[model samples]
Target: MDLRDRTHWIFDLDGTLTVAVHDFAAFKASQGLPADRDILRGLETVSAQRATEIRTALRQWEADLAHAAVPGPGVIDLLEHLRGRGRQLAVLTRNTRANALRTLRAAGLHAFFDARDVAGRDSAAPKPAPDGLFRQLALWGAHPDEAVMVGDYLFDVVAGRAAGTATVLLDTHGRHGHPDSADLVFSELSELTSRLATQPPGQSIGGPHASQKS
Candidate 1:
C-alpha cells in the first residue's frame, strides 16, 4: 500500500477536488424548480423524470462553474509533489469532457493533464460503474495493481475498488461514511502529500484482485 510507488493517480472532480458551486441543487434553482426542493431528494426525482436533459443541464452548468473553481486547500502543492515524483495522473469525472476541460483550464490546471487523460462522460458509464476507470487503465497500459484512486465520495471508492485500484479517500469532513474498500483515508490533500513521503518507491499501490468480473 505504499503510495509513493504508485504510478498512476486517477482523481474525481466535484467534492473530491473542488467544492461544487453549481451542483444539482444550484442547477435546479437556476431552472426555477421549487426553491424549497430538498437538494438530495429532488435530484433522484428529477433524474428519473428527465434523465437526459437533467444530465445535459448539469454538465453545462458544471462547465460554466469550472471557470470559477477555486483550488481546494493544498491541491496545487500536492499535485506538484506527485508530479515531481514522476507519477502519471489523470482525472475521471462524470461530467462531459468539454466541461471537465473548461473547468481545469479555468483553474489554470489544464497543463497538468492531457485531453485523453481527462475522461469524463465521453469515456463510459460514470462512477459506481467502474467502466471509466477500466478504460483509463487500458489507455495507460497499466495493470490494476499499479494504480491508486484518490477521491472524496463513496462512488469513487466503489469504482476504484471495482477496478482493483487501492482507494485513497479524501475525507475532508472526517464525517463522510467510511468506505470498507478504502486502503487508506486522508483528511485533506496536505495529508496525502505528507503520507506519500513515507511510502517506498516502486511498491504497488493497488491490491491483487480481479477487475473485469465485477
Candidate 2:
C-alpha cells in the first residue's frame, strides 16, 4: 500500500540502508560453525561462558564493519522526505545496538534517527520475529496499520507481516528478494522515493504482488 500514510517507519539496517557487504556464511565458517546455520541460534548450544565471549567478539566485529558503511543510492533523500513529513523512523537490525549506532554514524545517517529508536539483535528476538516492531509501535503509541517495515530480506517481510504492518522489500544487489510477501517492492531507494513523491493521499502503491523488478 501507499507508505505516505504510515507514521512509524521501521527499517532493517545493513543491506536495507547500506549496500550489502557482510559475509555471513564466511563469518560462520570462521567460527567453525555450519555455514548455513543461524549464528545466534547456533550460539545457544554452546557453553554460556563461551557464548558470551563469542557474542562479545561478534558485536565488536560488526562495529568494525560499521566504520566502512555506505548508504544506498537516494537513501538520504528518502530519509529527508520522511523526516520532513514528521515520520518516526526506527531501525530494527540483527546487529548489536552499538554496532547499529556505529553504522548510522559511519554512513552519515546518525542525524536521521534517535539513539533510543535503534533496535538491534539484542533489542528483541531478532526479526522473523515481531517483538522489535511491537516495541517500536508501543513507544510511538502507534498501531500496526500506521507503521511499515522496509528491508531487503525475508525476515523483514515475515516480521512485518507478523506485526500486522505493511512491508516494503528492497530487492537490490540481487539478494534476498521476495516480492510475493511484500506490500511493495522496488529495486532501489530512489524508486521508492519517486513513488512517495507521486503518491496521492489515501492511495497505496499496490497489493502484495505489486513490484518494480530491477
Query: Which candidate has the highest lDDT of all?
Result: 2
lDDT of 1 by residue, 1-214 (tens): 5667679999997666676565565667775565575333355566466756666676666767887976678888878888898888899987777878887877767777878899886778878789999999999999888898888878788899899997888877766655355777766777678667654576543322211121
Report, for every candidate in turn, its global Cα lDDT versus the true structure: 0.75, 0.85
Q: Please provide, for model 2 over 1-214, each residue's C-alpha lDDT reduced to its tens digit, 9 standing for 90 to 100.
A: 5677888899999988998889888777777666556888878777898788878878877877999999988899999999999999999999988889999999999999999999998888899899999988998899999999999889899999999999888887646545677888877888888788777787557524347322
Per-model TM-score, in order, reads 0.80, 0.91
On a 0 to 100 scale, what is the lDDT of residue 208 in model 2? 40
Q: How many residue pairs clash in each candidate?
A: 0, 2
lDDT of 1 at 97: 76
Candidate 1 has a TM-score of 0.80
Stretches > 4 Å off in candidate 2: 202-214
